[model samples]
Target: MSIQSFKFSLQTLRKEGGISQLSYGIRVFIALCGAMALSWGINQIDMVIPLFLGIIASALAETEDGWQGRVRALLITLVLFIITAFGVRLLMPYPWVFGISIALVAFCLSMCGALGRRYGVMAQATLILAVYTMIGLNQATHEMPIWYEPVLLSFGALWYGILSVIWAALFAHVTLRQALTSLYIEIGLYLKLKSKFFPLPTRGAVDSLRLDLAQQHGQVVVALNRVREILVSRIDSNPTNPRLGRYIRFYFIAQGIHERASSSHYNYSDLAETFFHSDILFRLQRQLSEAGTSCRKIGEAIHGGHAIDLRDSEETVAGVLRSIDYLEREAEPTQWRLFRSLRQLTDNVIALQQELDKARQLEDISLSDASQQIPQPRVTFRSILSQIADQLTPKSQVFRHAVRMSLALSCGYAIIQNMNLSVGYWVMLTTLFVCLPTFGSTRKRLYERIAGTVIGLVAAWALITLFPVEVIQLVIAVTAGVVFFLSRNNRYVLATAAITLMVVCCFNQVSDGYDVIWPRLIDTLIGSIISWLAVFFILPDWSHRQLPMTFAEGLRRSADYLRELMRFYQEDNVSEQVYRHSRRRAYNADALLTSTLVSMQQEPGHFRRDTELWQRLVIRSHTLFNYIAAFSAHRGTLIEQPSNQLLADAGNYIVESLQEVAQCLEQKQLVTDSSAEFERLRNTLEDCPSDDDERHYFVQSQLQSLLGQLEEIRRLTLELQVQVHGEHIKDVK
Candidate 1:
């Protein structure tokens, strides 16, 4: 990884002391202290029951929900945890019965993530509950009745659940602001990464920058989604909520700024060739870098709740504009088109700065004046259930993973039971944690887990040998638990190591820890091997099988956005609600494709036989979305609505062509070139009245530019189809 990438990864892991981090840390500390106090107060440190409950509750409390939702969800999970704990004990005497039952439960719980993020969290918590219960069974003593442990576990879970709700009630706004701050941080990083793509610094740098850009863009999309989810939930519950209205508007401004900031004006390679030695190109690069720095400053200010200096970015924009003017005059006649492109790029940067200014001023606006509803998908119980049903199919990736996990875990359980290893549950536990959705991820996790485990074991051994103090060991265990919670998402290897140390520490609280090390390592190896074998042999669904459908879905959504734009243009009374919804869907689809393509890259090389082609298709689809966004922005700015007959007709034709492209991709049909209709649309643009209204002329010019972009989309899609279908069709135009 580059230094910048490493820094980005580190920042993501540490969370940089935002309000969210503070809240999370507080909650974790509360859980720890509460659990430890109760355990000591009751004088039952043998079971370490409080520790289990506290850890489970703290881990599962990562829900972006309101107080009511968090409480309700936590209660539901508690019930499930109790049931699993008792049920596992009841079936422990019958190894075969227990194995099969556990396998089925694992399958169902793992598949729950297919529903949505909330359900995904529930699924993971349930899985952890199951593992915790099984481990308890392995350590079960004849002194305690079966119900005793289950009931005690439920108390721990309930206590943590109550604490979570209290935290939510007290710091809901802090959580929301923290989420928004994260979105801004990612946007800043994305902008900074994008700045590196300019001036085509070098061939080597270009590829690295592009990869970083793609990664950062994906992160930005994920952050934006979370922010939108939180805001939408608030607004949906109360549409006229003033605070939500202001925040939603601010989010929209950031979204708009990001759209413009990341939009591709011209090919970077083309820019390198056209203005290789031009001082203006370097000036533009510096301006972009400064803009990115300004974005980071704004993010920091937001995170810290401090005042922002808006004039700094404005001055940078002014300097960039002056540089553009100087270059425009210095350019020879041959460089006029290149100069125009450079000016347009600078204009986008300036627009982004203006949006940033507006965002900073958003606090002054009244809620009644801002858009009330946040753009998002309908998130209801019914919708989530329907999503679950839709994915419960043989073709679904989630289904395949669920089945794979069930089989792998069952095998691990059988091996452990038959061998009668001292810590047999560790084998199943390692298998459960190592197995991921994709084969590539599973393999990658295997390496990380093994390395992390060895390092953690060595660290634990050294600490115990050197200090040999119970209090210090307990503190180390608690610290490991805290770090595990904070670092799991961005630093999985570190989390694994910390969690391993935590488990060892907890074990030491009850029994001898001296003999646990070698067994843990051996069991981990067995589990990792089982997981790999199962994923590779059992109904493995490679990403190659799903890429076409994802590509088609992206194209279909782009077409929908185009049709919405046409409606907005023709009606001349654009409903912000409808336009925003369509745009959101399009952007979501693009993000989905980008994420899938990145996953596809991680799959086995043989499965990615046409990796280059798939990448081009994704790049083309992204470019298509950018053009559609530009069209939307340009159309929104027109003072006098241009005659929409030609534009509407053109939009309809383009939509139809895009739909055909999607169908061709999905059905493996030959792609027919749609250049003729695009040309006709261009020809019809001449009919737009070139009167004194400069805005009208600007709209005309934008439409012309949009058409050219559409033509590029058509060409790229046809090329992709030809590559996939292995057949080329003669051009009709």
Candidate 2:
């Protein structure tokens, strides 16, 4: 490659986290190579297999933590590895004891998820190491010391841990940078998806777009949460660092940008219908599209470690202003309300642009009142105990998963013992990797594992035939391992294939590797079937089962958000912390509901009861959230007027209606008719004198829109109740 092209390629890799993945692959490669070299130098080739397995398990247990945290984790992991390995060796002689022990270990390890993600990962790796101990013991060439496998495994884990700590020290900020980059990119994509709604469309098309928007918003929420976690961890470690402070501010700015970008002031269909012949809608669409581009550019800047220019965003804002001005000058008095809504949208976009500018010069930006330090969860012993105690029930998904995994592993072990398969531990290992907490995820892994194993077996046969030399196979094994680490997260199929190939090659070094192909395929198939059956039959946590609670939570959070915004309207000021917290919680709940609905669709047909009705509820709930956000976006001082009590009453009625609907859904009761009260509020609004100011008009229009959305949501909730429960406490009007 030419020098300039090579430079561009490196930059692209760094931006997209290809470099980080490559670095991880390289680390694994080095660990594998070092282990092999040490084994060969000492003429202890039997130790190579266990050492390699240990290194892989250690890498799997790794999480994104700072160097100090990683060091601490590494020590704990080594202790766990030694204990697990030695325990397996102790129980290996008795089949019944081994089977029961393995099941109990599986249960305890799986329950570690209740502690947190980091502990869960370490627990899984430890379980895998337990199986590795069995494999290593079976592969023993001669009688050896009882301490051999455990000692070597601990050494291997410690070696990998040291490498990880060194790497973390060198590249501490890279992960944070990548996470922020992804956050902005997702936000930009969300904006682009939202822009599609501005054009006139049919009702079906609008609902479809809304579903897509909600799903995309979920992705943005995921990215935001990841960035927040990393920032919180880093800041807690070194609170005085200026650079870390700047990143925190940038995160706050992104949150502000997302809130403004996601705000909807009025119904898109109404706006499109009213401004169909005018360019105002088209102008707004272009402005949104360009603002999305600006967000992406900001992401690029963050990734590339450069300053961004706001010239394009400035121009986009100016064009939007001109469109609004033209619309105001040409529109008649009756069109003022729609025009005012359009103005609110324009102002939101302008505010978004200003946040983008803040991202450009983060060094000079002062922290806003809303930019408080993200709270970190307490890690005390009491808190940890409480967290785990809460999940130790049949209702908790984690508890169900732990029970399922233990039973499945025990069954696999029994099959292995009864069938007299020499390489039967592969079945248990396969079960360990393929089984997950959810059916959809477990099913997905099952398919990928089977497909990948078949492909890897075929490829391994060809490679064994073409390159018969042992050293060549060894090199291929290490390379396959590197490829596995690189693609593990995004390309599970490819990763699975690579790992399978690596296992075949490594086995060939110690024995007839060709003999492993058929057993590998058979074990994979058996393990996958077991996992699928386990998820389907054992405490199946179907996504549809979660619909009632998820939907209720979404409505409740939306109500809380609306209540907060009403407080803002009345008091003319609300604590930024409180307001933002409410906004975040509402968005998070909505995102969860959207994501749950998606998972529900992936479930079996029979389990998806009232699918269409559930979808409508999701769309309507999201619409209600949008109206509340619109009111929040236009927060300002209101003049005392005759309609003030009417407005307050309207807000109170809407909030109470939402809360009541949520309660009814949760309780499986009927929703009472609110049409009369809704109608009275609308009549009062019409009779109230119209304020000349556009803000007043915008607020009134938003209240009207919220009332309409709440009514629709109530109707959908009642229908859903009827469909799911067959009867209700009372009938609706």
Candidate 3:
């Protein structure tokens, strides 16, 4: 709620670069122009309303999905838009009835978002269409036929859909490349932050570096999620396209590189103490930094459509080799261990370089083998219905948001109806757009909504007064629409300003533009204030209240990921689908927790009493995740399998312990002593086979690390419990 919040938001927005933005801008520009030309110039449609609404749909339907998926989504959206518009127009003559209808429809439409992120976007777009239908109904004046509104709305939606499908068809590969490049760039940035930890001889660097890494890792997860969505959706639709085949292959390679590149295998303190006298630490830092640079260079090559240069990577490897040779005197155990870790790290970097080289030889390899790697799930009607039905509960955030939004919209609608304010649809529009799920988002939207409205109204007034030309104003309105869609996700304030201007300017075609400005500003302010009050007093789902459960979910998911890793190693035949799915779930869960932790920081101070404790929990959770990732990377390279019984016993103990922690967090109970499991795992590790002790030693190190991490997690969770519930746990040494 402070100015710093807005500053941080702006800083985050600044990071989105490259072709994703360009393509979106192009898509929006093309969609708007196409709609305007078809409506205004050729078809002579009714007042460009359908075209404007379709432009809105085009903006909302922006996804990293393939052309086929985009088409599917838009077609569904077109159907929903027609239905919602027609239904609203049919009921508008009855005030009380219309209000009730709005409530019910709003709730149902909002609930559609509960299905998932894709459904959420479509549902939100349909909700906006519903609002637009209401506005259309109010403007009908009883003279126009009911079909007039819905038909025009459907036309605009269809127009945008066609344009989007066409854009995706033409630039499908380009879009895929952009998404991949973005993913790689984000991973590169993550590697850079990770490299900061290599200079761990500096005092107090570990904690700060881990904190920074956690935040950056959260962003990398988001980028990976986007890349996965695009690649998976594409491969699912048609697993035959060579280009898509290549894209998926590269995606898997990037996934591997990300896994190995970002793991903090050796504790920073351990590395620092073991290499304090040697310049090997500095060389290791340089190697990591250069490797990060190479990753970024690969991204640049992808973006620029050129071959990736590996000279820097070669130099880095050579430097790391020379440094390793200089450390030949392995006089101590720690020194040998450090040397091995550095060698493994160098190998990971080399593997990344080799992956990049393979990506460069894209056209030389047949991707027939790659298609078998990804399994596509069959989408069915029964499954869709089941998914929708599953969300029909109070616990789902989407459901609660649905209820909350409907109530807020109803209140706004009632205010507009009672006050009889001119241009009152803006009030409802503002309220609908402002009521997001979390308070932080709602608060941010409110601030941006009010500020953007005032700024937009003033700017539009000046434009209208100066130009006073219908054609000029129309062009400006179209331009504003495109800008609105382009900036909607990142620069909300800019989006609001552009959209407000577009709406006011378009409305001016029916009313005086200058006279409408003040009403628009006043209505926006009123609507924003109402939204603020609603979010504050309504079923406010505070992040702090949700943090404990979220943190527990993070632990559970990380444990699930570890279980999957163990399964991959224990079984001779590994299922890529199972491993990848579990990995994605774990990363997504951690990312969700990380984002929530950030949101909680911006909440009221009273709700953030345990901020420090929450940070520690997040760091520990992330570090635990990194440890599991390391085990996953090393799993494939084991020369001999360790005792499955011992591994199974340790994995079960960890999983059960994680479940216990999750339950305690949710139930707000004090944690019980859990040292017996840890001790047992340690004892099992001690009784390893001496014949293949080297192989067993690797397993021992991994399991011991896992145990140590679990103990730390237990302590952190107990500390959090004490902070939240004032309960003291009995110490068991």
Candidate 4:
């Protein structure tokens, strides 16, 4: 049943009109190949049928584009043909034919860019190649010979359109496979990372990782749908995943625990008070010890390049697998493998701790000096500027887009000018990679482009054979009409398909444009190659890094924000509220960067370093927010029993004061600036230790942890602040 449904879905995509550039380009090839063979039998050839088909097919490319894409394509053709007839002739040799042709084509493409990225690129490529052909052949400045020139160009255009249909089919096939592979990669990475972060077989941590992994899978759905957009409707309109709500709802439970922990208002604990105590310490030591042994084995495995054993990837993957001789029982294979991996991960965590300790020791100098400084005034102008730049065009992305467009068009131009190249028609091939999904590499994109082209050619031929020559013109007309209607909805690819069929019908069925097929095929191949080369070699945006770094930055800032928020909740220190905007700003920026990265991935290849950093920033920021949101709502309140009310109030006091002090040190220096509100919270904690109860026990449980986190925050802040100030600060010890 699933297989049948999947097949049905494929059929839907194939039958559907409106696709993107890649599909459109492929269909163009199909229309040419189909019409040429059909024309061999017909005494009379009219291009009207093929032209109409091409438009309809192109319109279907973008499902929602409605009739806009069809109109856009027509407008582009109309405007360019007019300009080539008038503009190219008058300005030739006077200002140089190259400059005029480039400018004219560039202007036309830029105008059509309103449709979408691929459309603009294709228009420019087509315009340049067509004009170059006319110029290179030294055709008359005035009117063309009615018989051959128009017929040939029209037929060539029709063939190019047919190739697009073939391209669409291939794209649909490849993307399905890619989506599945991506899901497995994400699952593996999640399991591996969790094995390192949570060295124990604790139910809580395991469940947490499981939930997060599920969310990751949901996100992959969005990514997959986005890729599928190449052959279907844009995914932006799709519904959000149902599993997302599960994570959010589950977070409430953790949130209660975190809140209970954060509510210690008068916490004045030192390192000994909240530092690593017996139970948690014992757990850590054991895990680290086990992890070290595991790491050694994993290293050996890595060196040997063998698949390690596994139990269940999501379950407990640690401890020695014991074989019971009496019962004849052994650890399951999955369990054994998982344990092996976890063991190796534990070793790495221990190794990482050594580096952490070294960094901690390096911070001995600035801790004391940071106690005496005051805060800096906030910058109003920069904040205002950031808020106001809503409509600002991203210059780097735009410029690179334009330059790449230039390279593709130039390739088309070179073929027309240099070789009178029949391959000049290949300019249509460049359209396939122009706006590839996933910001993938141009090489990979080109491969897809080539595929779509071949398939579209075949599809167009099959359609032509079924319809035959007699009514093909009618079919072309109807396709044109549909392309016109649907392009308004942004279904450019469908429109392109219709347009391809129409062009082929017009050139072959309506007129003998099939005679020009040989030259057109060469043009198709050349254009595809040149465009791919341009995108592959030219200065590319490091997309992967950008999205990741943005995520990471957001995560780091959110952590700081959460700490401040916790301070406010615990000690009534309202000051932490002032820094709230910092995290918000970081999140907003991260979101924008992520959106861009998602869009760029379709472009092709390795992402730039900064882009990767931005992506990391996004991931980290999301992690921090998710972690905090998962942990608390009231910040310092607890779900468990309390030691005493007095202890509770004290914990609250310390949490606030320390958090404020830490936050202040992040931007300035921390002075002994405890407010009346903070003092009140301290008094409250001092008063609360009457008897053991839920509140009292809760306070007792969280007291030490709160203090430790505060000290850690302060340590981090002092180190950063000192670096900002100077290197001569004296040691605190």
Give the per-residue lDDT digits (tens) of candidate 2, residues 1-733.
1223423533454433732676688789999999989988888766778888899999999877777788888988998999899998888889999898988999988998998778999999999998888878876767778899888988888888999989988877777777777777777777777777777568899889888888888988887887887775665555455666677777888887888777888777787877777777776777677777777777778777887866776887788788788888898666765776777777887887888888887783332322354666678889878888899999898999999999999999999889987788888899999998877788888889888888888888899789998778878888888888888776788888998898888888788888889988988888898999999999998999988889989989998998888887678557877877888899899999998898889888898888999898898888778778777667876777777777888888888888888888776678877789888888887676656866667777888888888888878877777777775355544
Clashes found in each candidate (C-alpha, N, C closer than 3 A): 0, 0, 0, 242
Instruction: Give Cα distance to truth, residue 462, candidate 1, Å.
Output: 2.7
Instruction: Name the lDDT value of residue 523 in candidate 2.
Output: 86
TM-score for each predicted model, relative to the true structure: 0.88, 0.94, 0.91, 0.42
lDDT of 3: 0.73
- Deviation of model 2 at 10, angstroms: 17
* Model 4 clash tally, residue pairs: 242
For all candidates in order, the CA lDDT equals 0.71, 0.81, 0.73, 0.39
Indicate which candidate wins on lDDT: 2
* Overall local distance difference test of candidate 4: 0.39
Best by TM-score: 2
lDDT of 1 by residue, 1-733 (tens): 2337635643853464433665665666667667766666788775564356435643564577767667777877877777777887688789889888978998888788797677777777767666676777676544567677667667767776777778877765566777777777677777776676666778666545655565666777887888787775555444455766667776787788778765776556776677776766666666666666666656666666787676766877788888778777687676765555566677778888888887677663454556545544666889877887998988888888889888888898889878998887788888877888778888999988898888878877777777667667767777777776676665678878887887777677777666788888898899889988887788885777778888889889989988887665556677878877787788888888888888778877878757876776676667567667666654553444446455566667778877887887776776676667677778888676646554355445556656675677667666666666564444333
Q: Write the per-residue lDDT of candidate 4 for residues 550-643, one digit (tens) a residue.
A: 4334434544555555444345345533543443443344345446555554543433324433333333233334334322322444333343
Error of 4 at 15 (Å): 10
Sequence-dependent TM-score of model 4: 0.42
Candidate 2 Cα misplacement greater than 4 A, ranges: 1-19, 364-371, 693-696, 728-733
